[model samples]
Target chain A: MPYVNVKITNEGATPTQKAEVIAGITELLQRVLGKNPATTVVVIEEVDTDNWGIGGEPVTLRRRRGL
Target chain B: MPYVNVKITNEGATPTQKAEVIAGITELLQRVLGKNPATTVVVIEEVDTDNWGIGGEPVTLRRRRGL
Candidate 1:
């Protein structure tokens, strides 16, 4: 069993995209570690860009710079 | 910052395996969200079979059942 928590800056990701990501991560665990996908839990949390930072700069600023 | 926490059942995972998982997650964030890897934090937690629960049963019991 695995509990995977992924926090991504809330830029712009469709629900479909997030669902695909969750499925991909679950598949990764099953294929690489032989983990059962039935018991795996994947939670995706979208953090506000203001709360997310990169290299000490807020993600909002980075996004504005096209980074 | 993107904090990715992965909790895997501590049945059998080498240091090398954990490293690969961490690296893969970091790359995923960078590629998907354009988040800088330098600010991404990936922590792999080894969950004891006794503590991890799945399908309303402890992982230890589930493992014994080959689930």
Candidate 2:
């Protein structure tokens, strides 16, 4: 079975929101990519602002310095 | 930084196509989600026809039995 790993960082997402996103992805894969929902596994990883980056720069630092 | 994992099954996809998809995803995350491309990780899994399924059914068996 095809394995799809999806990680999205959303500081404001609640547990329910995370679950919804996973379900949505599963549905999308089944309909769009024709993947088997049974075999498809979705993994969601939430990263804190400190651990994330943008344009090869640390997001936390940028936000803190107002850069 | 946001991590988005995309899994697509394409029996006809080449290695180059896979790389292209990864790049596209990275770019999309940067533009759409304002994620850092440096920290974004994309993993693509290629499932064999026999190993994949659809609609809670085994895709391989369906294709084989011509169902």
Q: For this target, which candidate reaches the highest DockQ against the unseen true structure?
A: 1
Q: Rate the local accuracy (lDDT) of all candidates.
A: 0.80, 0.63
In model 2 chain A, the worst 10-residue window by lDDT is: A1-10
DockQ for every prediction shown: 0.59, 0.31
lDDT of 1 by residue, A12-43 (tens): 87787777777877877777678789878889
Please report the candidate that would top lDDT against the real structure. 1
lDDT of 2 by residue, A1-67 (tens): 4455666655566676656656665665555455577866767666777666676776677877885
For each model in turn, which proportion of the native inter-chain contacts is also found? 0.56, 0.42
Indicate the TM-score of model 2: 0.55
> Model 1, B1-67: lDDT tens per residue?
5788999878889888777777777776676566678878888888888997766888789778876
TM-score of 1: 0.79
**Model 1: lDDT of residue A10:** 79
Query: What TM-scores do the predictions have?
Result: 0.79, 0.55
